[model samples]
Target: MSPTFPARRRGKARVGAALGVSATLLAAFGTAGSAQATSATVRHGVFPTVSGAAQIRANAVGQASSDETLSYGGGIDGIGVMSGQPKVYLVFYGSQWGTQTTDANGNLKFSNDAKGGAPVAQMMFKGIGTGSEAWSGTMTQYCDGPLVSTGATSCPSGAAHVPYPTGGVLAGVWYDNSAKSPRAASGHQLGAEALKAAHHFGNTTPASNRYAYYVILSPHNTNPDHYQNAYCAWHDYNGDTTLTGGAVASDVGDFAFSNQPYNMDSGAGCGVNFLNSGSAGTLDGWTITLGHEYSETITDQNPAGGWTNNIAGSPYQGQENADECAWLKGVTGGVGNVTMGNGTYTEQGSWSNDTDQCALTHSTVS
Candidate 1:
């Protein structure tokens, strides 16, 4: 069936509470810092570029304090978070990836991956559920259940909370090389690809996809949704109608996915050397970008359906957990390297409601 684009909710033409870029930054980046919601489908969890993050910091320079806390958006589809064990599927979209090979660490590698990002991504997922990693623990603080009221800032006792990927979140990885990925794939096209991936992984029902998410990784040189020009990456669901192509008709249910472009394509604008310097930091942006999306997906699996800032007239009104702390460094809960079972990776902090701060580390919830 052809995908349908419906006008469910009006999407913003630019990034709002997420990027936190002021008017000056918006003009400088020319919409690069925000996602364009040309249609009615709201684009949620948009990750900004380095310049956008800098603008967020600059906007807060003189402020004595700011409220970045998140409140529930009243569950959408009766779902607030990935309350179950989250399963992440990596889909290498397009034939441009060239030949695929396995690295010594058993991670997938591709000859066309100029920056050696494929394996790094695989390893990052593998390491997430291992080694008592506390990064994922930060998200455990948010929850969705009957006991928790809508717009509640903190999860009440017994509220169904987001579970840590105890074993691991990396469920499967596939290379969809059936066709060349569009040079500039639309939001609908990306959603369609994710649906294709769902079918490929045998997740053909809503229950099977309740906690599943697909990361649509574009080829190295291509710019999926013109991300290279505006933002680094963004996360949304198949149900969002504002997608460039349209909202995908998913018989399996509304699935969450992220448009993970080759971050190396945008250099510092996408996080190349934002954390570290020299060869050691080449893939710094890669992990941070993907991690940012992953954190948002599990928490806000259905966009605003989960935990997000819904406070009226606040600077972070619509931002998600990770959006509250994007690109911050050298402070509490800023960007830094995290040790996982697989290896150490650089990642950004996520918003924690319990502590009412951006937490880089938190005690495991369950």
Candidate 2:
């Protein structure tokens, strides 16, 4: 069957919350400090760059006061890890994508690299779950929440904290040749497409996708949700809305999906990493957005049920783990190289309530 558009998220665009930039750290990296996860000294080989531990620790230390102290926005869910490990499946939603090329490491590349293609995202996801990377390990604090509840802060006696994402599988990739282009697609349609991808990959059962998420990458030049005007990209589970998609409110279980826009908006607007500027940074930004959505999905697979703050008057209430620190970088600390297996790509840092700060390098997995 052809892909169908789901209902709009809120009749209009839902803007992502803008975060205040950190001046203290940015000055540390300097102007030329802006670069992808790969190190300046090394060309393309997998060499570990500076973990930025010193900078992150120093930054956290300075914020020791309540004025700077940071804590998890809300309660944590003890299911810490995604059951087994972190697993991801890439779904190229439209046929507009051109030929596919394979890299030396058996990863797939795409002709539409600028439009948030496979090449950019592959490198980002490659080494994420491995090596107890900072981004993944930062989520350890969330494991300390209650066993089951909407707004949990402390874990019940004998309960476990949310485990960090140690390592996992890339799962696989599937380009929906049968599905039509997703130009001007609605949010509901995006959810439907995710369900289709799940079925196509034989991940129909919840067990197969317990800790899995479907990333729907739209072709370049398409506006998934007014990308240039409203928000870069957003993550949410299926059946959350009453849109006219395949999965209705009566759907069996929650299905996590992210509407990744075409890189046309480039790095600045949509979170792509075009070396912090220009159209060329499409892949980098795409990977950044992917990591953001991926992090949120693992922590809050079903949105608020996972780990979200709902306290009144709290600035972060209703925000997920990644949402709290979205687009906010630590300059010398935010962006860094993560050597998963063989690839390293510069991705953004997530909120670490444990340290009450945002860090690019997490020394301990907890």
How high is each candidate's TM-score?
0.90, 0.71
Candidate 1 per-residue C-alpha lDDT over 1-366 given as tens digits, one digit per residue, 9 for 90 to 100: 000112222334444434432343333345443333232223345676777667655665554334667777666677779999999999999999999989898888899998999999999998897898899999988889788887788878888889988877899999998999998888889999999999999999999999999999999888788676567888888887667776789889989998999979888888888888998889998999999999998888887778876554444545688887888888999999999987999999998877777888899774
**All candidates' lDDT scores?**
0.79, 0.52
Q: RMSD in angstroms, all models?
A: 4.3, 10.5
lDDT at 34, model 2: 33
Q: What would the per-residue lDDT of candidate 2 be over residues 1-366, giving only the tens digit for each residue?
A: 000112212211121222222332222222223332111110000011122223323454434322322223232222323434656788887777767768776766667654535765766676676765566766555543344343345335554444555554467787776756666776578888888877777776666666677888888777664444334566666755533233443132456677777755543444554345565454565666677678766665654445554343333334455554545554533655555654666566766655665666665443
Task: Name the TM-score of candidate 2.
Answer: 0.71
* RMSD to native, candidate 1: 4.3
**Candidate 2: minimum summed lDDT over ten consecutive residues — where?**
40-49
Highest lDDT scorer: 1
After superposition, which runs of candidate 1 have C-alpha atoms over 4 Å from their true positions? 1-43, 62-66
